[model samples]
Target: MKKAEEVRRLERDRIKNNIVVTSTDAKGKSHEDIIHAEQIGTKIITSELENTAGKERVMKNKHKQLQERIFINNKLTWEEREKRKKMKQRMEEEKKKGRTANMGYQKITIDGKQWK
Candidate 1:
């Protein structure tokens, strides 16, 4: 029974250290509050974990807009597609050269028409 109590105390300490709470006061200052294990629920911990996982998934798919423009939108001509490919290659080369990578798609103008 003493060993079980000791294990529970250790687990509670771990939980207390892990649970973080952030709030904004009326003066617009941000404050971070660490929650104790006694004030936290299993649902809160699971939801926070899920929220973090969701953010990572979103970051992984940050190129969804470009993908949609290239694959889903069939309005682009072959020449425009080739230009976009070249731009992407140039961006990759710049990254390899230790330059800042440009992730924004360049606006392509062909014959007074603008295509993003």
Candidate 2:
């Protein structure tokens, strides 16, 4: 009988010193009431996950925008389109040649004297 009363007293003390917190998520999902001490940790983890998900969503949206831009910008008259295509091909060729050629820096002449 004495041990039972002591256990009851301890349980009451524990409940009195602790708190239960309940939260709802963005999706209208309700979470179970958790101990107050754990609430901060739970919120931190939830925010981290939400932050990463937001970053991924933004990246996907940017990629979609880039694809749309490329398509829309390429829509032009045949002459203009062909001109742009040729310009792009020339740029690619220049890039390839630049990668293979290592032309050292040329001396810059200023006031009839070569500058370092």
Q: Which candidate is the best by lDDT?
A: 1
| Backbone clash count, each prediction separately | 0, 0
User: Could you tell me which 10 consecutive residues in candidate 2 have the lowest summed lDDT?
Assistant: 68-77
- Cα RMSD (Å) between model 1 and the true structure? 19.8
Misplaced by over 4 Å in model 1 are 1-74, 107-116
Query: Which lDDT values do the candidates have, in the order given?
Result: 0.40, 0.35
Write candidate 1's Cα lDDT for 1-102 as tens digits: 999778767664443223222222111112132122221333222112223344354335535635333211112334545878987776677678876655
Error of 2 at 28 (Å): 30
Candidate 2: regions farther than 4 A off: 1-64, 67-71, 99-116
**All candidates: CA RMSD in angstroms?**
19.8, 27.1
Candidate 2 achieves a global lDDT of: 0.35
